[model samples]
Target: MTAPEPTTDGTYRDRIIAVEPGGNEFIADADRHGRPSQLVWTWASPNLEFATIFLGVLAVAYYGMNFWQAAAGILLGAGLGVLAHGVLSARGPRHGVPQMVLGRLPFGFKGNAVPSTLMSITAGVGWFATNSVSGAFALSTLFGIGPLPALVVVVLIQTSLAFFGHNLVQAFERFAFPVLAVIFALASVAILGKSDLGAPAFEDGVGGLGGFLLTVGTTFGYVAGWAPYAADFSRYLPKTVSPVRTGFFAATGLFLACTTLAIVGAASVTIATDATDNPTDAFTSSLPEWLASATLLAIAIGAIAANAINVYSGAMAFVTTGIKLPAHIARALATVFFGVAGFLIAWWALADAAASYEAFLLLIAYWIGPWLGVVFADQYLRRGHRVEGFLYDRSYTNWPGLASFLIGLVVSVLLFCNQERFVGFVVRAVPELGDITFFVGFVLAAGCYLVFCRAKIEAERVAL
Candidate 1:
């Protein structure tokens, strides 16, 4: 459990333009620099884009929630996710490793591969593609340069930032914070001014408890999706950093940005309800030409900010999968691989962005909910224990944790999934129950892990 020796001279400490060395290795003490306050921007800047806003749009436009209903659901769901994010972020400085590496404590080295690979794919290709499409659409809307060309431009900038790695990613997010925040704030005001706050839910939408829960799940998916990457940013901070302040700032920034923008999306859709085909264009159509243009630029910049983290953390997660590669270049190579894969996926997704995105958001919550369950349960059981050595112990295995996770995932999805492609029997039988798969999965996984992992964790604690 002893910390890794401080290697190198910390040359990349403040060097934003430099390619960050190492791939999911323990961060040396020399490299541990940055304040907890910086997390505010690190978290905030990414959510200041159209993707966050679109979550709200889906609540009302797709999920039959009234503005107030959507707002309440957004608050409940996003608040839960943000709380989890703060706790995870607080673990970073103490661990000095990527979140997926820390995940070894729960799922063990080999078993951890399940969630690690899932995170790699979800964050890398899934989110990368989602944001890339949004950014490209914004560019096309702003400049009439067409989607393909705009996609190329967006992908290159984000991929470059991610390729250079963490320092550049953090710096870019910090730099982008003010610009994206200001424009989105203005757009929110304008959109709200035009919105009908008292408007009733859409008749054709998924009304009642089903609609409300769907809204909650969608918003939860959007915000909580960032939880796995929480430590990836904070792992570089000095160990002396206050966990409370770190969690507070990270949670505050995420809550403020995500809630405000999503509310704006819900409000905007009250006026532009028929925007299913092109939600991005519909979102900005209500604003003045100048403001709209500025908003489009912000969305594009925000996409880069968001995807940089996606690709960076995705690479980090990919490396944690026990893949053999030159340590120095493993993460960088993974970054490139994800970037290319994401670009191709994004191109295909642009054809049906709205429908595709709704499914993607919900899909994120499906696995994440159960994964969070197992990890949090494991973390709780191992409290006050130093298990850092287990991270590098390739032979360590936790099949019970793995079993619980899969059980929760499969059972919940089978009974409660409610997507366009598939609806679970629970919803099919009782339509008002809504899609509570995330809630069910989380409880099932956490309960199962707690029961199954108790003896193992006790043995581990005694051994330590």
Candidate 2:
């Protein structure tokens, strides 16, 4: 989910050590009061994440639109993620802490509990269920087996990879990146040769404003989670790395890759109705004859790599909130617990998700988008470019942050999601609440914090 700065200052033994791409050193022990280097730059090339979610040609099938419209929708989504992640990740490295830890500054000690627990639950259960279903569905495309067996296989693979944490996940990514490229490249070539896209219809059949906003809203809804980890990865960089470069390398790379992949997936679906509800079918269609099974393996591995990060991040969030368990144990228990729950969810509610995955994606957006908005705005605008001990100090309490975070979460869930239907029978639902819900959370959190800070000033004056 993130990186840590390598501890070289000979300070605390408790720092999280991490190395950056340009050989930058980072020590994730901001409070080098006692701990040594727990910080580490354990791995590299974080594998075009945050953006890749939108890139599968299989997604294109839902709208059945031409390449241009799909590309536009993906681009809009990528822009939102890239901007959010770029600013947010840079802040975490300077603070030498994870995003959720940083979140404590705005949400207060107990206030952060809700967001952290929610995120942990979602990442653990939601990601596991979705990935399990996708992987199983992919295998079904090849083996002609029923969906149940595929789900079991996917769960087993996910559980195994999660045991190793980010080390194995990053290594798998590095190992598999080339294969993904080769297969995708080959498929692109074949697809291009077979059909001339001619000119794509962007606004065609969109009819009016409703269709346009719907498309934008859908993409934004799915991309909500990727924004939260900006700090998780950025917290490892040397305090000196230009935020511009950090944002570009990490956020831009993720977004660009995602948009490209989504276009390809959309293209795949537009071209072939044989496309499975899962996008891996896109790969199988273009894999060279000699390497048929390799496609399936890559998807399985890809799912594992993704879910590994998800499990790790979710565990960190949950443990931080619980504030009792050590990181290792917290990660372990949360990983298993969420995995099991998510598997059950998949077994029942997710049986038909492939057909209505977009709806669920929108519900995620309802929650994740507003949360990201509040966190990112608070870190950059309110913190004034410095993260200090006061953020974690017990005395400060951050009542405003706590109040605002809670209020915003409630608004997004109750107003944006439940107003229609939060979770449909197949997937989470989004019945089009408009953009106001997104901004409302940020404004409410910020406003509440300002009010609380002002009230505290008044109370102290009156006492004096």
Candidate 3:
């Protein structure tokens, strides 16, 4: 696990080509490497893909917001998520373990299984599937290949990167960053060049305040999807690294990439009315053929960049479930399993990419909001207390955390849900309210956890 000494040039580190060892275990001091600023590209490259762009597309194309309105939602939504990401990621170097593994502090090794299992499926399979669809579409368009075959190619590449593990993932992202950034920047210019920036909100669409809120939720959902995986990438940084720098670089990268691309997506739809039929193609339709082809390639590469982290962190989340297996290769094996599952799901989802993507994004927000509520609340309660032992304490249980999470989830979904599949009664009665389930869920869960866990957390602190 030993890493090479930092080079004078500040460029070299561990063998990026080697398969990373361990499964959600604490990264040893000898292995800890890299600076905080590098987190920028590590977070940015992934969001440069079409999946992120479609978030904006959904705002203008489906949710009926004008470009200006969509931009506002994108900023507000992505801004909040990015801020949370910075705060969460700042805890990584101190913990020196995968993000999900830290759940043991609040939920206990056993209770943490709930969120771990969900994240494993969500990040590994759900997000993997979601991003893969866009990548496959790009490949299919670029190569004239069938969607299924294109998906297979994309999945294999993404999974292989995850299977090899962290260093490779970081290196890939760094390599991908410049390429993705340049192409997306050019495409955005082209898209905006043809856009009607003054276009009004569509009358037939969701429209007005409801449309704005939904757009906000959707964009937040997109960024929130990355929240749980924050520390997984940063755990290898030296403990002395500045948490502020770590968070700032990561958040800035995510904010810039997601916000910029989403705005481009909103602008693209101003001209490409066929966005509903095929988002990826419609996005590139405004550019010249050569630039469009390059943009398509960038989109495919960006998807792979995003899913590398997805599958890797998904495996890390699964391992945090405390499931016994061949300890050495558990993460790698899980990566393979999830990769296959994601491919299948992606295949099924290709039939209706636009609808499926929108649903998946909002669903991510629903669960993640509550989970984050409990995590953040627990962290706040346990502040100034040394709770590292709890990370591996099987007997350590925090029933309050679990209770708060479930209560928040159930109550919010039953009251404020606004999805097409199942609108909550409250939302149904007031259709213009849109979805605030994620926000309500977070507040409820956090408030509940603070009330229920205070005495217990204090007692645990005193015991420590």
Top-TM-score candidate index: 1
Q: Candidate 2: what lDDT?
A: 0.54
Model 3, runs deviating above 4 Å = 1-13, 272-276
Number of clashes recorded per candidate: 0, 39, 0
Give lDDT tens digits, candidate 3, residues 137-220.
Answer: 999999989989999999999999999999999999999999999998888888888899998877778988889999999999
Of candidate 3, the 10-residue stretch with the lowest lDDT total is 1-10
By the TM-score metric, which is better: model 1 or model 2?
A: 1
What is candidate 2's lDDT per residue for 324-344, written digit by digit as tens? 754335556666666777778
Model 1 lDDT tens row, 204-296: 998899999999998899999999999999999998999899889999999999999998899997885444455578899989999999999
Q: Residue pairs in steric clash, candidate 3? A: none
Q: Answer with 1 or 2, whichever has the higher lDDT.
A: 1
Shift in Å, residue 297, candidate 1: 0.4
Regions of candidate 2 where Cα sits further than 4 Å from its true position:
1-60, 63-65, 143-146, 192-207, 238-240, 274-279, 282-292, 391-396, 409-464
